[model samples]
Target chain A: MQLTDYEKQMLGGENGPAVARAMDLLVRYGEALGAERLVETRNVAGAFNASTPSIRSMAEDGFDRVYSELNLDSDDVVDIPHMAVPTCQLITGIDIENHALQGADPGLVDMQKDGERFFGQRGINMMCTCTPYQVGNVPVRGEHLAWMESSAVIYANSVLGARTNVEGKESTGAAGLTGRIPYWGLHLPENRLADRLIDVQVPVEDMAGWGVLGYFTGLQVEEAQPALNGISATPTLWELKHFGAAAASSGGVEIYHIPGVTPEAPTLEAAFGGNPMPDPIVFGERERVATWERLQSAEDRSVDFIMLGCPHNSIEQMSRVAELLEGRKVHADVALWVHTPRALAEVSKRSGYTDIIREAGGVVMSDTCPAISRRLPKGVRVIATDSAKQAHYLPAIAGVDGWFGSLEHCIDAAITGKWRGGP
Target chain B: MPDGQSTSKIVMRGRGVVPGKARAEALVTRQTISGWGGINEREGSVIELRHELRGQSFAGKVLVFPGAKGSSGWSAYFHMCRLNGTAPAAMIFTRMTTKMALGAVVTRVPAITDLDGDPFEMIETGDLVEVDADEGIVTITKHET
Candidate 1:
């Protein structure tokens, strides 16, 4: 890989040992991808938090050790410098204030707080949500970003028309320090176009429908860009967010085109960028039903927990949840927790969404989700969630069988403590 | 040394991203493996509910699959597997994505890709295999001719 003069200087240890180590990791990672050069990136989001119990020993050593080893994949224990570019922390493992509710160890929570302070001092914005675009750092069309979190990467590339591959922890860490990522894969213009198309035969009018479509699309084309046709409804940020997150969860899809809906694809013909499109895979009623059924692993109707707002919720979603929950209490046997971005959680507080949900015996949370934290309600053997990404992961990560359905279904389950929703 | 064993050895070539060698039983799967929500790092087992290798630990085996799929947390999970001593002895994957490449690098395992021949067709789980990633070669010793 050809490094610029400034990159060479950094790799040669002119800036500091940390920058040099960061550059070194970039070189190896770039070469592994067969990239010929590195591109400058001013935006980066990554998992820089040391919140997991597995990293307790390293955290005991110091946050620097955690950053050096986990982020840069280095062993040198270099003092982390201020980020060279704009950087933000993605969804962390534990919520700062709700650890007790999630049954997390207090020691781990304290370690996370320390990590945030150390890294935050180094200029990393603690956005603390997977959906950073919803919170504020919205990148414009054609902007290059180095980001981790597959769901966020897919959302940025597909909805926002920003370019980013699904970067790993080490790669994002390196990019945050060096402002460079490999100019390969999705970073290149030629690779972003759809090579195939999918025909949506069923009406995908709601967020749940979009989630099913996204999951089905992923199963049809793993890692391949595909444009969707036959969707009649105009989707809001909420629907597209769920769509992208669900797609990335089921498959490693970084970019997708909705033809008329997304920014890059103004028309079906434009979606392919002049390449010959393959036969359209049919995502009809059967496929949609199958995909929805595939997401639910629970057979027992009794629900123990209902988790919402994966990729974290937008304020509108928060309002809708609060509306459904007004004057109602969650089932005494079940727990209901609503998650949104930390910034939006504050807004929810002022908007009375938090108060409304709390009054109804549900909790409003931020900074983390059960899947990322692996911290479900204690003794949670069965769960239900509106988010397809959460449904796909929570069952596997939290050791609980889960049901996948819409917000109404989840909320109803929260009220009755039963998995009455179905495919 | 188990020298002069009656089994025939065949050496295949590929692009070796990480440099090291390990001889272990092959745990082959045609399906792509997920790293984050798909596996238990401490146990080194594929835990994705419906994955073909569900509940199977790859700790001491040469994990042969079609590279990583699902979450960008791929590398982190594999990295943790290394820390926990539950990582695959070597990784032999067909496709190389940023997730798998970074994962192989951080896990510090012997990893090879871009094979001249189809590894899935030639290798099977429980077969003795030796991965020499430093030289980009895999020697497979089948139990039956």
Candidate 2:
């Protein structure tokens, strides 16, 4: 990899040991990925540290060792005093506030608290959300960033028009220290061009429909950049969130283009970057329904848990849930947990959405989801969720039967403790 | 080391991203492994309930799969596997993506990818495999029953 003079200096330890080590790792990582050069990341949109048992086990070895081993892949411990740019934590192993609710032991919770404090003291924002953009870490169009979360990576590249690859924890951590990343993959302009075209034949009128469309599209164009056409209406931010999250989960889609909807693709021709568009892969009602059915594994109608907010709920989504739960009560046998960002939870509290859901026998939590927490109550054999991403992961992670449905359908399931299975 | 006939070796070549060597039984999965909490770090087993290899342990075997899936935290979990001494001896990926590449690096396992043909088509579970990643060769030794 070709390194600039500044990068060379950093590699030579002119800046500091930590920065030098980070630069060295980035250069090697870039070379391993066939990158020709490194690029300057204008701002660190967010940095998600990996919370694993190995990481927690390294607590005795101290934070520097944990960062070195997990993030830098080195044994030489170095202090990361501060990130060069603004950064935020992603969903950690345990919900710091509701550890008992997630069935976490006291030791695990204390370790999580230590991890939180380590990053917090280093000037990293301890938001602990997958949806950082919703919580004051928004990166604008054309900005270069090193982001680690898959959903956030897809959303940044596809919807926000910002450039980022699906960075691993190591790469993102290195970028946080050095404020740069290798210029390769999705970061390149030519690589961002859409190679596949998708025609939406079904009416994608809501967030669930958008998720289904994204899920199908991801399977159709695995690891390829896709441009969508034939959608008549403009999609909201929440819709795009679901779409990007599902696409990233179902497929290895790092970036996508929607000609009229997204920022980069102002026109079809522009989306293709002067190249000829491939034949459109038609996504109709058949594909949509098939994808929805594939996500549902629950044969029984009874549901023990209804979980929402896989990608972390935005304020609008929270408001909608509150509106749906008004004057209703969750089933006595069911537990409904709504997850959002900490900042958004505070906003919802001020707006009374949190209280409304709590009054209805549902709990609104923050900073973690089922996939990250990897725990559920002992009797949670059957679960229902509105998010396609959650539906895809919960079964694999928690070993629970899942029912995928629209937000309204999920709310109805929460109310009656049964999944009738419809929007 | 078996008392059967001479070991029959079928050698295949690929790009070696990490340089090392290992010999172990193969644990093959056509589906990609989700990174975060996809495997139980302490046990080194596939805990993803929907995965074909769910509940099966990948510890000390050559983990063969299509590639990585899910969060960028994928490498982190695999790294934990290494720290816990429960990671696979080596890995063979049909397609190399950022998540898996980083994972291969962090785990420091003898890893190879971009094979001449599909590794899944040829490799199977219980096959005795030898990976010479430094030489970019994967030798599958089929032990006759």
Candidate 3:
């Protein structure tokens, strides 16, 4: 672990006590990861699982405690995505319903308070929600960066070709404070090249298809980065967003590529950086079905809940759901809710998208999702979701039957209040 | 300690997340735990439905898994375990995710990742194990052995 003159000076307390402390942590993180040098990050995003009200209250408390304990001041705030002050008006009603903190899990609320207070005291803006790309922190195609969220890191690395490491929370906060990260792993241009080629001949449409494709790729490569040879045009940032989110949700990877979308791979050969292409895995219709089959549990019983928006739902996704249930109503017996960032929720409200969903009896909430709040609604016997990542873990954590499938299946369950298995 | 502990030297490889030492019973999970609401905040036990080791305590166990599944707040769940006095003795992961890594660092637990052998298979739910993260080795002694 070598440090530059500036880094050494900072470590020596030359850059004020606050910065010096942050730098110390970053240096330790860098050493832990075996990084040789440090690099500058242009922008940073905030958080992925937002907290609920009870959780928010707890966060505020935690902030106050950490504030007094550390005697920290306001000048140390970091300019990042989710931490920014609420730029958009927020609408909160039923969105926090199905989460782990339904009636306010006291411990969870306290933890949330701890997080909120920590960031608040540190002068970090607490804009609640995931999908920081909607607000800001949009890394240009091919920029070097460091971010915390799995979806964000994968999207930046795979679609934008921006280099990054899936560094965790503390490191992200530490990096944001100093605006520097270790220049190793994906940050290096040479490390971004594709080691495996994933050829997908199956139809790539619906968001679920892309998500399934990601699962397939992740399962095949395990943790290695792969280049997708056959695919439709480079997906929009939104589509790539879901793909990356679902992919990283299921597997451990920082980058993947479509022949044209990623900057590193303007062409197939270019994506390889002129290196030899690894053997290709032909992923066809059978492979898609097999992937789906592999994920299905085949144990279907009436489910009490269904959840969506793992990385938090994008505005467009919310709009689509709103349109689908324009005048219809959700299953009265089953609980159905949508999750969105506070900023996006404001936009949806102004646009009347919130009203449309609300009028249909489906509530939309902002600032927190189920996974973070840890507050599931009362009497949830079984839970089903459109996200494999959610389906994979929710059952184990929530103590219920975790069913998997696409939006249609989830909506059907939401409509009938019964798990009809998969289509 | 039991006399002549049934310890076996099984070489496993995993990318190291944090560098330290930890030893305890092996608690391997193929079913990834949900980031939120998965573990009891106070009890540090698996409460999630369908989890292989549901109702089991993580305390003093050498937790093994593939990687973190969802939520960037994944570290917070483990942090709660630390607060509840049920933190794992150590951890071995086949892959490293930012959430899992943060949990390891925040919890100040020893962890070794990128294992050469499939820990999900080599380790069982209740095998005594010692994780020497400094040497990147997981020594497991099966209960029945």
* DockQ per model, Cα: 0.81, 0.61, 0.33
**Comparing 1 and 2 on lDDT, the stronger one:** 1
- Give one digit per residue, the lDDT tens place, for model 1 in B34-91: 9999999999999998899999999989999998999999999999999899999999
Residue A348's lDDT within candidate 3 is 82
Which pairs of residues collide in candidate 1? Answer: none
- Per-residue alpha-carbon lDDT of candidate 2 for residues A1-423, written as tens digits (9 for 90 to 100): 898898899899888888888887887677667678988885553444434454566777778877777777776988776887776677766777777888887876777787778888887888788988888778888889888888989998988889998887788778888888988888878889999999888789998888888888777887788999987889998899999888887887889999888888899899999898788898877788888888787899999999999889999999999999998999999999999998899999999999999999998888788877777766899999989889888887777899998999999999998898763
Docking class of 1: high
In candidate 3, position B144 carries an lDDT of 77
RMSD of each: 1.4, 2.4, 5.5
| Candidate 2, residue A14: lDDT | 87
The backbone clash count of each candidate, in order, is 0, 1, 31
Q: How far does residue A416 in candidate 3 sit from its true spot (Å)?
A: 3.7
Instruction: Report the C-alpha lDDT of model 3 over A1-423, residue by residue, as the tens digit.
Output: 677788788678776655565576666556656678788775655442224442344244444333221211123432222221222111112233333435755555455555555555555555555566666556687676656666767877876667777755555555655667777788888888888899888768776677778777776775577888778765655556666766665556668877776777778888788889888988898888887766655365677777877667778888877777777777877777777776777888898989987876676766655554445678887787777666655565555666777777777787787777543
The 10-residue segment with the lowest total lDDT in model 1 chain A: A244-253
Off by over 4 Å in 3: A47-102, A105-123, A294-303, A418-423, B1-58, B62-71, B91-103, B110-144
